[model samples]
Structure formats: structure tokens, C-alpha cells
Target chain A: MSMLEKLQPIFREIFDDESIIITKQTTANDIEDWDSLTHINLIVAIEKHFNIKFALGELQSLQNVGEMLALIEEKVKKNE
Target chain B: MNEYKLKDMIVGLTQSFSVDITNEMMDLFLRLSGDNNPLHIQREFAKGMGFSDRVVYGMLTSSFYSTLAGVYLPGKYCLLTGIDVSFHKPVYVGDRLTITGEIEFISESTGQVEMKARILNQKNEKVSKSKIKFSLLE
Candidate 1:
């Protein structure tokens, strides 16, 4: 599966909606429940799904799903 | 209050202040924020959920970062632009928390200073941490 495909399920699960289709442009403004509290939950879920850790600084810099997927791909490749 | 210029802030400049989390403070926050979550206001409900007592609203604990930046770090003539916080533990009534802010970075171009903010309970456990961004005002 592609990175977007892998990430799509996680976003759906975090948002508790099956219809969330994410692209590089997808951001907090596009989601209904993407407040600060849920943002942490989404980050934690993404970290666990990817089996990686995100530094607080890195977390602050990610502004969209594409950036997040790029970071995840980079981290996963580094770990392999 | 001391007016801090962007050049005056050096990495490792620090300030510390303490606040006692009293029931009255919680009540005041509850009213101001209109956060009527039972987890913070109802003892039996909180106890049922495994907390020893009502959990003081997490934002109330996090609010100290504002106090740290606006009152002490830059002290005077400061405008808080942003804050990113992580809550590690729940705060309960009567827990005395020491809030500390340390300068981590200063940008001369933007007149913005980034500070690492932390809140530790009397037991010396960190309950919350935040990175706060502020700019010195003229």
C-alpha cells in the first residue's frame, strides 16, 4: 500500500469517520474534530501506527497530511 | 516590570513562579471558561473514573504559561503569539505547582522569543510542558 493509503485508515479511525480521504493539502481546517485535543490524539495514533516517535519540534512543524506522510516515510525508511 | 529588548534575552534566561491550585481557583476557571466537564467539577464522577479527586481542568494548569510569559520572562511589553502544550499528568485541588520558563531562542528579525515552559507539582513531577512564542512590544 502507498503512504496515503496507509495513512487514510489512521485518519479515519482518529476522526471516527470512514469517509476521510486525505491528500497533501488536507489540514485541520478540513476536518470537523481536529481541535488541539484531537490533534494530539491523532498524532499519538499516527506515531503508534508508524512505530515511530515525533519530537515536539517536529510535531509543531507539520501543517498538513502530506508533510506528516513525508515525515513518516522518512522515519520508516531510516528505521529499516 | 522590566522591559526586555530582543537583544537582552539570552538562551537559559529563566523565571519561576508558583501557584496553589485551590478549589476557589478551579471554580473561577470553571466559570470563566464555561468548561463544565464533570471530570473537573464532580468529585464522585471523577473518583468513579479513577482519579483521586476532581481533576483540575487541564487548561487551568496550562494557563500558568501565559502568566509566566506575560508577567515574568519578558516581564513587560510582551505579546504572546502562540503556545503549544503537552499535558503529562492530571492536577488535583491543593497541588502547589511551580511554573518555570526558560528562554530557548530569540529571533532578532521578528523580535520573537521562544521559551520552554514547565509546571511541576510540589512532589517535583512535571505535570505539563509547553513551548511558548512571544514578541517584545515597543
Candidate 2:
């Protein structure tokens, strides 16, 4: 499955919203519940699901879901 | 009670404490929470429900988790961020509960520590388990 397809469920579970449809341009501003606390929870959940650990500052610059997907893809590739 | 700085905490570090559940504790909990459920407040009701006596409030039993965080594991620097807990068995008044916690994960970048903890009664049966997370304020 594609990265977004895999990430969709994680988003749904974290936000407790099954209707979330994420796109390349989907930013935190687009989600009402995407605050600092949930951001941390999202990062932790994403890291666990992808089996990748993000170093400090690696996620600080991400502006949208597409960037996050790109980062995960790169890390997963590196792991392989 | 012991105070631990952020630098002092390591993965696998563990702390254990014992708490004696008493009538005063139950009275205090009732005063504070006003949770007067018959199972918790009435011995006859609890006995009819098959428990040996009045059941202790689950929250009261779990409240010691705060002591575990604030006084033991990471100690005075702890700022609890979250807790995920499960009640596996019932706890009753007059039980001696031993609470133990161990650091499972430490994030130096965020100054956060996650601990796996459990409470066991005098009978050595686990009554509750928790995953507690806190930020260490340096």
C-alpha cells in the first residue's frame, strides 16, 4: 500500500475521527484537534507504526502531511 | 521520598512503595470525590455483590500513581503528562497495596519519561497496571 493509504488509519485513530482525509497539502491548521499535545501523540504513533525513530529536530520543520510522508518513506527506505 | 533530576533517570530504573488502605482513606476519598456508590460505600451492598467487603474506589487506588510519580520515580521534577491505566481486579479496604514503577522509555530531547507500573495487593495479585508519562522539569 502507498504511504498515505497506510497513514490514513493512524490519523483516524489519533484524531478519533474516521472521516479524516489527508492530502499532500493537509496541514495542522486543517484539523481542529491538531494541537501541540496531539502533535506529540501523532508523532509517537506514527513512529511506532512505521517502525522508524525520528531524531530530535527532524520533525520540527514539517509543515504538512506530505512532508511527514516523505520523511517516513526516506526512513523506511534507509531501514531496508 | 526522594528527588531525582532528569540526569538521574535511566531506563529500567525502578521504585517501589507500599500504601495501606484505611477507613480514613476511604472517608477522605468520599469527601473529595463524593463518589458514594454503594459498592464502594456500603459493606452489605458490596458483600451482596460478592466482594468480601466494601470495594475501594478504583480512582482512590489509582491515585497513589500520583505519589509514584511525584515522590518516587522521577520525584520532585515530575510533571505528569498522561496516564493510561487498567483495573484488572477489585481492591478492598484494609488491603496493603504495593506499587512499583519502572522507567520503560526516556526521551532526553523532550525530557519525558514513560514508566510501566502496577499495584499488587497483599495476596500478590495485580490489581491495576498503568503506563504513566511525565516531563522532567530541569
Candidate 3:
């Protein structure tokens, strides 16, 4: 599946919104009810799925989808 | 909804946990949000702002509610369908916060449950309260 296809379920599960459609530039502010706790829940779900643990700094530094994709790329490379 | 089910949850499930406020914990939360409110970073600024010292982030206390949900309910049990939170008072450094929650309502068919959550200081001062709702399953 493409990255967007993969990220869709993460959005749906974390925000409990099956209607969520995440674009490359999607940010938390774009979605209602995407608060901090839910953000952590999303992080935990993503980590579980990809089996990559995120550093506190990486999690804190993520501002949008581009940053998330970059971080995922870096994490995937490190693991490889 | 089974009256016995709600009573059983209240009697056997609800629990309370306490955590003391510290500068380290405060700074961790501040760092996470990049919230550098001088009132939270400096004692004099806090006092000047009518507070004794740095106060806890309102969301920090709210997060504790998640801790409670994760522990008592466990796993996806906290389908936590909905929630509404309100900040009532400020938590200060050195305050011992006791987070307490109780089951208020349950609808088995609808798969919805309502809970009342509260954060109180050692002195029993209410710091925050919320009406939280969750689903028993997906």
C-alpha cells in the first residue's frame, strides 16, 4: 500500500474518525478532536505497527505530515 | 444496561492514584509543549502573577485521566467514545495531585459508558474535572 493508504487507518483509529483522509501536509490542527492525548495514542499505534520506537525529540519535533514522513524514512533507514 | 454491571464497576474497578508535583516533571511537560510561560519557569514571575510558583499544565492533569483509563480499563476497552474536560483551578509546584475517577453510567447495547473524573490537591482542592465517555469495545 502507498504511504497515504497506510496513514489512513492510523488517522481513523487515533481520531476515532473513519472519515479522516490524511494528505501529505495534514496537521493536527486540521482535524477536530486531535488533541495531545490522542496524538500520543496515534504515536503508540504507529510505533506498534512499524515496530519503530520514536525518540521524545522526534515526537516533539513533528509539526506536519512532511516531518512525519521524513522521520519515518530516517527510522526505516536506521533499522535497515 | 445492567444496574449490577454499573455497580460492579464502581465497586471493583474505580481506583485513585497520587503523584507529587516537581520541577522536573513540570519541565518535561513544558518541553513537550514548548510552553515557556514565565509564570511556570520562574518563581518570581509566578508570585508576581498572583501564584506562589510555577503551575501544572492543565493538560498534564487531563493526561492523568488517560493513565487512569489505560490502567483500569486496559487495552481497547477504553474505546472512550467521547469526553469533555474543564479546568477549574491551577496546580502548583509541590502540590500532591490525586486523580480520581468513577463510573457514572453504562449502556451495554449502545456500547457507551460515562465517567466522572476529577483531580484534587493534597488539601482536597479541585484542580480539574471532566465528563468522560467511552465505548466498551470497537
Candidate 4:
């Protein structure tokens, strides 16, 4: 499966909404439950799902789903 | 109390201790929490329900998770974030429970740590399991 497909369920589960459909332009502002705490939970869940770690200040630069997807792709490719 | 700082904790660190459930604990829990459930207070009622004896309140037994996080794991700077718990076996009054917690994940950017914990009876049967999350203030 593509990385985005793998990530979709994580978002859906975290937001407790099965209807969530994320795209490159999707930002935290698009999701009702994507507050600071859920943002942390999202990061933690994503890290676990992908078996990757984010550095301090690295995630501070992320603004939307596209950036997060790109970061994960880069990290996963580097690990491989 | 443990004075562990965020930098001092690493994944896989573990802490364990034992506590006894007593009549005074049951009374204090009933008086303070007002949980007068017959299943937790009346042995006869519990036996009627097929439980061996009056079951200790699940919350009372799980309350040790607070002590595991606040007093042991990352003691001084710990700020609890969340907990997910499941009770597997009925815990009775007078049971000695051993609580064990092991660090599972740590997010430095979020200042968060997640640990997996379990409460085991003296017979080595698991009575409860939980995942606890906390943030470090420092």
C-alpha cells in the first residue's frame, strides 16, 4: 500500500471519525478534533506506525498533511 | 520518591512495587467516592453474582497507577496526560497486588512518555493492565 493509504487509518482512528479523508492540502484546521493534544497523539501514533522518530523542532515545521507525508517518505526511504 | 528528569528516562525502564488491599482502603474509597455497589461491599452479594468474594473496586485497585507514575516512574516532574485501563480479573479485599510499569515510548518534542503497566495478584495472576501517558514538566 502507498504511504498515504497506510496513514489514512491512523488519522481516522485518532480523530474517531471514519469519514476523515486527508489529502496534501489538509491541515489540522480541517479536522475538528485535531487540537494540540490530538496533534501530539497523531505524531506519536504516526511514529509508532512507521517505526520512525521525529527530532525536536522537526515537527514544528509541519503545516499540513503533504509535509507530513513527505517527511515520512523521506524517513522511511532513508531507513531502507 | 523518584527524582527522574526527562533526560534521565529511557524506553524500557521499569519500576515495580507491592500494595495490599485492606478493609480500611475499601471504607475510605466508599466514604470518599460514594461507590456503594453491593458487589464491592457485600461478600454475599458478590458470591451470589458468582464472584468468590466482595470484589475490590476496580478504580481503587487501579488508583495505584497514579502512584506508579507520580511517585516512581518520572516522579518529580511528571504531569499525567492520559490512561487507558482494562480489568481482567476480579480483585478481592485483602489481596496483595504488585504493580509494575515499563516505559514504552518517549516523545521529547511533546515532552510525553507512555508506559505499559499491570497489576498482578500474589498468585501471579494479572488482574489489570493499562497504558499510562504523562508529560515531563522540565
Candidate 5:
């Protein structure tokens, strides 16, 4: 599966909504429950799912799903 | 308002201030935030959840970051845009918290600075930490 397809389930699980569709442009403002607290939870969940870690600084610079996907792709490649 | 131009801000600029957490302050914060979580308002509930007393709201403690950025660090002519904080420990009533902020980075193009912020309790334990970003209003 593509990275975005793999990420879909994680986002759905974190937000507890299966119908949530995400694209490169999707951001916190697009979701009702994506506040700071949930943002941390989502980060943790993503890290666990992908078996990678994100630095606080790195997490801060990611403004949208596209940036996140790029980071994940980079990290997943490095691990292989 | 203290006039602080973009040229005036430099990395390593720091500020520290203290606040005493009181019952009245907690009550006022609770009312203002409309966050009536039992962990913060009910002592018995807090104790049942393993705390000695009702825990102070984390946001209440984190709000000091705003005071640091707005009133002290870049002081006046400051516009706080964002804050990212992590709560490390519970803040109890009557805890005296010393909040410190240090400039970490300054974006020349945006005139926005990122500050490393921390709150230490009376016992010198870190209760929370944050990165606060703000811009100097021209």
C-alpha cells in the first residue's frame, strides 16, 4: 500500500472517525478534534505505527499532511 | 508600549518571573476556561486518581508563557502567535512557579522568534516546558 493509504487508518483511529479523508493539504484546522492534545496523541500513534521517532523540533515544522508524509517517507527509507 | 524593533531581538535573550498558585487563582481560571475537570476541581476525585489534592490545570500554568513573551522577553509591541507546550508534572495549589524564557531562534524574514520556556516549581522541579513563537508588532 502507498504511504498515504497506510496513514489513513492511523488517522481514522486517532480521530475515531472512519470517514475522515486526508490529502496533502489537510491540516489541523481541517479537523475539529486536532487540538494540541490530540496532535501529540496523533504524533505518538504515528511514531508507533511506523516504528520511528520524531523530534519535537521536526514535529513543529510539519504544517500539513504532505509535510508529514514526506518526513515519514524519508524516515522509513532510512530505516530500511 | 516598549518599542522593540526586529533588529533589537537577538538569540539568548532571557527572562524569568514567578507566580504563586492560589485557590482563588484556580477558581478564577476554572471559571474562565470552563474546564471543570474533576481532577482540577474536586480533591477527593484527584486523590482517587492518585494526586494529593486537586491538580492545577496545565493550561493555567502554561499561560505564563504568554506573559513571558508579551510582557517581558520582547516586551510590549509583541504579538504572540503560537505556543507548543508539554506538561511534565502536576502543579498543586500554593506551588510557587518560576517561569523562564530564552530566545532560541529568530526568523529574519518573518521577524518571529521562538523561545524556549520552562516552569519550575518551588522545589525546583520542572512542571512544564514549551516553545513559544511571537512577532514584534511594527
Candidate 6:
């Protein structure tokens, strides 16, 4: 799958919104159910899927789908 | 993104700690925040208003979520990037609080980590609920 394709699943699972179609521009305001409580769950799910962990700093900086996709590529390269 | 070798920073990470809201602590919260809101500082005001005693600051309890997110979860994580919070109910002075954190998502792609979090006061009342969005590094 392409980078964006891989990312949409993670977003969908975290927000518990299967209909969630994450675009590069998608943000917190775009998702009706997105909130602090579920945010942590999203983090955990992402970590498990990538078989990697994110530093707190990186976790905080993520702003949108595009940013996350960039970081994921970086982390995958680091793992390789 | 701040990355630590888990073991090194475990001592202070996600310290899933809790404290009973003692009368003294309530006083401290009141004094520190200068939130002498009659509903929280005066017994008469509290009782007449239908509360047992002066209540504690909603933030005091919500802060536990901070400890859980900024500290634990990923373990040896970076400082929190941003946080969003909500106060649901009144937190009385003598309430017992319980807070917890568990990792559900760690995205290697965006360096974004998300967790499920909440805080509840003694009466099993949910005092605050929030979804925190933190980024890597500073």
C-alpha cells in the first residue's frame, strides 16, 4: 500500500470512525468524535501497527495526516 | 521527538499517581489559583449550593491525565506537545481520585502517540475528561 493508504487505517481505528477518510488536510476539527480520551488509544494502536514506538516529542508534534505520513516514512527507514 | 531508553526515565514517567483531596490540599489549590469562588471556599456557600464542602480545582484532578500521558504510555517520552481537557462535574474537597493510562496507538509514521485517559473523583464522579494531542520534541 502507498503511504497515505497505510495511514488512513490508523486514523480510522484511533478515532473509531470507520468512515473517516483522512486527507493531508484532515485535522482535529474535522473529526466529530476526536477527543483527548480516545487520542491516547490512537497512539497505542499506531505503535502496535508499526511495531515501533514514538517518542513523546514526536507524538506531540503531529498536526495532521500529511505530517504523520512523513514521520512514518522516516521511522520505517530508521527501522530498516 | 524526545526518545529515551525507557529504563532511564521510568522513575518519573507516566507516574500513575493519585492523591486524596484533603482539606489542606483544597486550601492550597484555592490559595494558589486565587479561585476564591464562594462555591469552593466557603462551607456555607458550598452547603447552601448543595455541596458537601469547598471543592478542589477541576485542573488538580485533570492534571493526573497529564502525568499519565506525558509520563507513561510510551515510557521515557518527550514533553507533551498540546493537551485538550474538559471539566464534567464538581470535585469536592474530600473526593478520592483514580486515574489510569494505557497505550493504544503509536504511529511510527507521524511520531504521534495517542492514549485513552480520564479522571474520576471519590463519588465515582467523572470530574474531568480530555483528549490530549502531544507532539514530539519540546
- Number of the predicted model whose DockQ against the real structure is largest: 4
Interface RMSD to the true structure, each candidate = 10.7, 2.4, 13.3, 1.0, 10.2, 7.0
What Cα-based lDDT does every candidate model obtain? 0.84, 0.89, 0.71, 0.92, 0.85, 0.65
User: What TM-score would every model get versus the actual structure?
Assistant: 0.64, 0.92, 0.56, 0.96, 0.64, 0.53
Assess the local accuracy of residue B94 in candidate 3 as a C-alpha lDDT between 0 and 100. Answer: 84
Over the true interface, candidate 5 deviates by an RMSD, in Å, of 10.2
Of the two candidates 2 and 4, the one with more favorable DockQ, higher being better, is 4
Q: List the residue pairs that clash in candidate 5.
A: none
Q: Number of the top candidate by TM-score? A: 4
lDDT of 3 by residue, B5-118 (tens): 322454234657888888788879888999887877788877888976776778877888787665654323465555678988889878899987777654432334567888
**TM-score of candidate 3 to 2 decimals:** 0.56
B-chain TM-scores per prediction: 0.96, 0.96, 0.82, 0.98, 0.95, 0.72
* Candidate 4 CAPRI classification by DockQ: medium
Worst 10-residue lDDT window, candidate 5 chain A: A36-45
**Please, what are the lDDT tens digits per residue for candidate 6 over residues A16-69?**
678889888887788887776466556556666776667756767778868877
TM-score of 6: 0.53
The parts of candidate 1 lying over 4 Å away from their true place are: A1-80
Off by over 4 Å in 3: A1-80, B1-13, B73-76
Clash count, candidate 2: 0
Correct interface contacts retained, every candidate: 0.00, 0.05, 0.00, 0.33, 0.00, 0.24
Clashing residue pairs found in predicted model 1: none
Q: Please tell me how candidate 2 rates in CAPRI terms.
A: acceptable
lDDT of 5 by residue, A1-80 (tens): 98999999999987989999999899999999898655755776677688776654777778899999999999888889
lDDT of 3 at B81: 52
What is the per-residue lDDT of model 4 for residues B1-138, given as tens digits with 9 covering 90 to 100? 998888988999999999999999999999989999999899999999999999999999989999999999988889988899999999988899999999999887777789999999999999999999988886
Q: Output the lDDT of residue B28, model 5.
A: 97
Better of 2 and 4 by TM-score: 4
DockQ each candidate and list the results.
0.04, 0.36, 0.02, 0.61, 0.05, 0.17
Per-candidate Cα RMSD to the true structure, in Å, reads 8.7, 1.7, 15.3, 1.1, 8.4, 8.5
Count of clashes, each model: 0, 0, 2, 0, 0, 40
Candidate 1 lDDT over residue span B1-138, tens digit each: 557767689989999999999999998998999999999999999999999999998899888888888888887888887789999999999999999999986654335567999999999999999999787877
> Better model by DockQ, 3 or 4?
4
The better candidate by lDDT, 5 or 6, is 5
